[model samples]
Target: MRALSYFFVIFAIFLAPLGVAVARHLADDTQATDWRTARRDSTGIAPLPAQTPEAVIHVYAARAFRWRGAFGVHTWIAAKPQGADAYTRFEVVGWGVSQGRNAVRVGEGVPDGYWYGNAPTLIRALRGGDEVDALIERLRAAATAYPHQHEYRVWPGPNSNTFIAYLGRAVPELHLDLPPTAIGKDYLPDTGVFARAPSGGGFQVSLAGLLGVTLAAEEGLEINLLGLSLGLDLSPPALKLPGVGRIGMSEE
Candidate 1:
């Protein structure tokens, strides 16, 4: 019992800085009530021009809505197959589910846009000849067949992160490197706790996204507690902290 108490104390000490950082971000005087009132333009992370290029796929993630941004991020996948004129994006949203609308939205839109007010960070980019096009096709199939099409949960399971994470698993060739701040990305669609990590490069055991452990090549090893994550990225020698996310020079 005493050991457990010590462990928690140490954890809190490490998490303290992240909490402060998030608090500072939210301390910004500017605020908005409606989601639409927030920014939605691209941050110029996408290299594809307005003309739209074929054989391209971009996976992006950004801080989630409102205070939740302090804890985790929302993720989405966008792809433009060969000869396609526009990009198709796939992601899950909770607000629509509450308003009698489908949780999953798939269609053409800005391949990269602000999530609420948070500028997006591109995680994976694949573009080339016919070979890249083949992977994009698989991504489309996996996205359309998402198991939780009508379901949505803000925390733990089947949220935006879950949607894109599932795609990474379905098509591992993309080699997704889901950030630790993507809170719901670890939820396995299966009845069992053990399953493939979102990167599809390792194994993970999660309990409805509340608690879990992951040991994967892309993500390294991580522990999820109370919807926040902390881990070590052995591949790049960095510390994955809760509120602050990854710290240290990342080779990625």
Candidate 2:
């Protein structure tokens, strides 16, 4: 019992930095007002020209609104067809289903708009080409087929990240490497202990997102505990922590 106690103490010490990081992130983004009044406009990350006559696909993630930002991020997909003027954005929104609408929302809003005041980070990008256009079709199909269009959960979920993760599996061409902070990305739909990893680069074994293991080139080897991911980045040689995301800088 003393040995076990020491083990737990060591584990808690290891986890302290990550926990502090998460708390700091939440404290920094906390706003006094409610979410409805929070800013949601483009944060200047989108292209200068909102309307583009080019084929492009971009997957973006931003901190979730309000308190949720501490634990994870919200993700969405945007695609523009050849010669299209505006981008088509696809994402799962709980509010939609709460009002008796589909959780998946398609709109002509800014492709890289800030998600309820949190700035976004581009996760994947593919631009102008017939190949990208083909991927666009697959993206649309994946969006239409999302099983959780009527469901949403803030944690361990079929939330927004789950929607994007579904597409990541369905459309392997996108090669979506969802970040470690995307809490709902591991919530597999069916009742199975095994499934393709979200990156579509390798394999994963998850017990309804509560616990899991994943191995892939994009994500390396990850152990998911209650939706928090801890892993290593094989290529970049970094540590993936729950609150801090990736540590170990890379040469850009």
- Number of colliding residue pairs in each model: 0, 0
> Which lDDT tens digits does candidate 1 get at residues 1-252?
999999899679657866775886688655444687898877777766455565788889888778887777888988887777778888888876877888888898888988878888888888887898888778778877888887888877778888888888899888888888887887777535888888888898888887888999988889887667788888778888876777877555
Query: Backbone clash tally for model 1?
Result: 0
lDDT string for model 2 (1-252, tens) is: 999999698567447656876678757835425777777877766554345556888889987877677677899998888877778898998985776888888877788887877778887877877888898898888888888878988888988988999999999877777888888788897656777888888999888887888999878898887888888887778888886677875512
Task: Give the 10-residue window scoring lowest on summed lDDT in candidate 2.
Answer: 45-54
lDDT against the true structure, per candidate, is: 0.81, 0.81
In candidate 1, position 99 carries an lDDT of: 71
TM-score attained by model 2: 0.90
Residue 76 lDDT in model 1? 91
Return the lDDT, model 1, position 10. Answer: 64
> lDDT value for candidate 1?
0.81
Task: List ranges where model 1 is wrong by over 4 Å.
Answer: 10-14, 30-33, 49-52
- TM-score of candidate 1 versus the correct structure, residues matched by position: 0.91
Question: Which window of 10 residues has the lowest lDDT sum in candidate 1?
Answer: 45-54
List where candidate 2 sits over 4 angstroms from the true fold.
Answer: 1-15, 29-32, 48-52, 250-252
For candidate 1, give the lDDT of residue 46.
71
